[model samples]
Target: MSNSDPVLLIETVRPDDGRTESFWVALVITGVLLLGGLGILLRQEQTSATDTRPQLDLLQRQFLMELTIAADEIRFITTMNSEVSTDTGFVNWPLEQLLQEQLLPVFPGQSAKAWQQLEPGCLLLPQPASRIHFGLVLQQAGSSIHYAPADVPLPDHCETLLSWQRMDIQS
Candidate 1:
């Protein structure tokens, strides 16, 4: 053989085996399918998360609005009762008006009652009634809890009360 002979340096190319080629193709296809499935799962989770955020925001806003209205109703009732108690030594007209107008609309199944216990008087003199009592009877029917008198309080003569209560709902 000569040093420069082309036949001495020639390299033959062999065909791939069917089993090996099929194994490699299956592996690549399985890997691609797994990656695609994972990608779809991740995208679905992200979309669900994105959709839930706005719904949560809307629920929070609704709760806040309801709380505000409840606070306003409480304030109006208390202030009207206090005023009438101080003026007439009994809460009669204001209590009736408040119950008929404001309280009925806001708290549908609730009723407001005022009581006056007069002081003991001598034979010729009348004792001044010093205290007035206002009570609210509420019948709550839905999932929401009624705002109690303790739950709603005036803020330094302010007409509104701001408070937060956490609620959980199963989806």
Candidate 2:
């Protein structure tokens, strides 16, 4: 294949047939398919959220029940303990240590920081939500467990609202 030698060149030509129209049609079809797929995914996501609502409600109910039981147990313990002063409720009992050893174990993922003692006899455990500015608070006061969706920040002193549901345990 010397440069000087006569080279036989073959040129291939593409005809401007209806294939160009097919390309645009395919492009439009692809776009429509992609949009449809995305719409389906969005619908499924909405459905999933609605589906989980009932489950979430059920879970909250269960959690509240467990918290009630825990509160009752703590109340009984404090009542029985000689060190604890009944005048000041949980004043003399090792409340933090007690919660760490007992309550925190039942709630696996809850951090110790999440549990706050509003007072000697009162405790506030906030139930966090994904997008809500307000949170539901589980309050344990003496022998009863109370819960409410608190729109306002919890005060230093525990105050029960009339709207709040209190589970009065006969300890």
RMSD of each: 15.1, 15.9
lDDT (0-100) at residue 69 of candidate 1? 54
Clashes of 1: 0
Q: lDDT at 113 for candidate 1?
A: 37
Task: State candidate 2's TM-score.
Answer: 0.49
TM-score, every prediction = 0.25, 0.49
Q: What does candidate 1's lDDT look like per residue over 26-85, in tens digits?
A: 999999999999998888734343432222245334543554454355445545555333
- Residue lDDT tens for model 2, 1-171: 788999889999889798989999999999999999999888873444343222236656677677666766665665565445546444354457756666532334656567666655556666565211111223224455555543545545655422345544443
Which regions of candidate 1 deviate over 4 angstroms?
1-17, 45-171
Computed on alpha carbons, the lDDT of every model, listed in order, comes to: 0.34, 0.54
Q: How high is the lDDT of residue 41 in model 1?
A: 88
